[model samples]
Target: MLDINHIAKTFNPGTITEKKALVDADLHLQDGDFVTVIGGNGAGKSTMLNAVAGVFPVDRGNIVIDGEDVTDLSEHRRARLLGRVFQDPMTGTAAAMTIEENMALANRRGKHRSPFRWGITQKERSMFRDELARLGLGLENRMQAKVGLLSGGQRQALTLLMATLQKPQLLLLDEHTAALDPKTAAKVLHLTRELIQDHHLTAMMVTHNMKDALQYGNRIIMMHEGRVIVDVEPEMKASLRVENLLEMFEHTSGGKLDNDRMLLS
Candidate 1:
């Protein structure tokens, strides 16, 4: 469960370069709630995610996750409570590390560190293999291969696995599949759905693809000008088509849909 209460953030405030990223932004996710967030560029999509992740202190707001108020906590302090998969495949995992090695590192995340020892045990390797096999990407067989050798989709899938390995209280996916080709993106998205369901994880996914937004989540939220403009529940979102979403966006935000990428999608 997560709650973002009346959060507002502005960068370079009181200056010519000042930009208001989030204004009176409030969102809440119940246990196992998978919410898809869609908005055009500069719509505060990533800003909201980063704010929850504690990428920077929100100027005004309290973020609570599973009953803990983490608004003042440092990013590293909150990292233990949240799992994030970035847009870039290269961002999450160590390139030179073998798939198994990377997983070993992820497995130890959020745990108390001990400086005395290191090495993957047989049980961990077995668990990692079982988990990798679930992705059906043949990563189980390539456990010993360096992660740098994996394709973008493969790497993203593996990163997804890594992010959920600890079953964090919330999962933040920031346009994670955007960089992959369409076919590969679909595979990664499928894997994402499978993992979230299998773990009963609460998640927020930011996406530019309208169809993907409507097709995947239990709820869909449209953001505009730093605020959540439209929030649709499962039943409503299920019956709604892309054109309907566009119409809602125009009506609610009172601005034309200026995102060409979203339109083309």
Candidate 2:
């Protein structure tokens, strides 16, 4: 459902700050394929996701989603095909808006909004409540509460629900659980897996945790210096351990893993 062909992105080209975020990176994801991305700092993991999301135009190559070429499409245009959860919990939703209000905006994503019809209907409210209840966080009762008042984990969970409310062609999770405590992170991760599997959604999750990269997704890809060096399929990933992944990285990238956060995770 997603194809990235020979994509490359170089920031501030011809300048001293030139950084090659992606170098001829290529990847393909079938429908319902959930892939976890792991790499050290500046490994182009998030860059590839942003490129697919059209955050910025790539220097070269094409990106096709569901058979539609979106390489030249703007970020807002691509929003119709993508549901993204950022690394920061606060990035996805309006803090001042009520929970139901935030959900209403997500539900209307990519649709023409008429100012004449701006209020949430009772039916939509009921649907939002039901969806919030599925999170098991008691947010259904607090639909009228401000999103800013919720905890980090609660906000992230709500963001996840909103992102998948209409099931985009692809879901981009940029370390959506990185800021939460371990327990809360696990809860959000579990919710992530459940939602993706239940809806048969295609997803790419960028994570620093090796165990998480191995445990949550059907396939795993490791990047280094802007290139995808290792792509492990489901069959091989199922039998691999954390140490095995580290060894693979060293062998393929020709260097030891150096990210402290990744190592500790």
Winner by TM-score: 2
The lDDT leader among the candidates is 2
Clashes of each: 0, 0
User: How far out, in Å, is residue 166 in model 1?
Assistant: 0.4
Clash pairs detected, candidate 1: none
lDDT of 2 at 177: 95
Cα-based TM-score, every candidate: 0.97, 0.98
lDDT of every predicted structure (CA atoms)? 0.91, 0.93
CA error at residue 28 for candidate 2, angstroms = 0.7
Local accuracy of candidate 1 as per-residue lDDT tens digits, 213-265: 98897999999888988989877877998989999999998888777777777
- Residue-level lDDT for 3 in candidate 1: 94
